[model samples]
Target: MRERGFRLIRLLEYAGLLVVLIATLAAAGQEIALMYRQGRVTVADLLMLFIYLELLAMNGIYWRAGRLPVRMPLYIAIVAMARHLTLETPDMNAWTTLAEGGTVLLLSLAVLVVRYGHIRLPYRDEDPDNIGGRRS
Candidate 1:
């Protein structure tokens, strides 16, 4: 029964992921179409496309690995913050701009810390049941 439940849950996860992947592709296509209509691509358009690419990569990695890395979302967040600041800089107040810049910096530092931890303290086992690879 437990195994059956896990299987069902995994099926739902795959379905959800497939939906997200399709939606992302559609959005990217729309963005490209809009750029074509405008006859030129701007920095904001490029950043938005880059975000889509990152989402696709993240989806692919999750599908293959059965696990999502913490860094992938962090990278996406950093790019998103940059994009937001770029688009809003003209009208944004000084404090708001500083806050956004600080957020990007913090996310970058988080990525570095996660990378360091993964390298310095590598996982010894792939078993999910084995917490931290410590034997009971």
Candidate 2:
């Protein structure tokens, strides 16, 4: 019974992920279409697209591995901070800009730490195929 319940939960997770994947794709398509109509792509627009790309990659990783890495969202946050800074610099005060930049720097450092930890103390039975990072 527990195994069946787990299967049901996993099925629901797949369904939810599928919805997110579709939404991400649709949003990306709309962004592209809007850019086409505008006839010009600003750095902000490119950054938005890159964020979408990262989301898709995150989703793909979760689907393939049944686990999400700690770094993907941090990377997204860093990109988002940069995008926010770029778009808001004209109106942002120096303090706010500095804070946002610092946020990005902190997130970058976090990624490095997580990566180092993974390398220096990897799972003893991590699966190279990314299948739940467990040995059979």
Clashes of each: 0, 0
Candidate 1 pairs with clashing backbones:
none
Off by over 4 Å in 2: 124-136
Off by over 4 Å in 1: 128-136
Model 1, CA-based lDDT: 0.92
Worst 10 residues of 2 by lDDT: 125-134
What C-alpha lDDT values do all the predictions have? Answer: 0.92, 0.91
Model 2 has how many clashing residue pairs?
0
Q: Write the per-residue lDDT of candidate 2 for residues 59-114, one digit (tens) a residue.
A: 99999988789999999999999999989999999999889989999999999999
Instruction: Provide the TM-score for each candidate, comma-separated.
Output: 0.92, 0.89
Residue-level lDDT of model 1, residues 35-86, one tens digit each, is 9999999999999999999999999998998878899999999999989998
Q: What's model 2's lDDT at 31?
A: 96
Best of the candidates, TM-score: 1
The C-alpha local distance difference test score for the whole of candidate 2 amounts to: 0.91
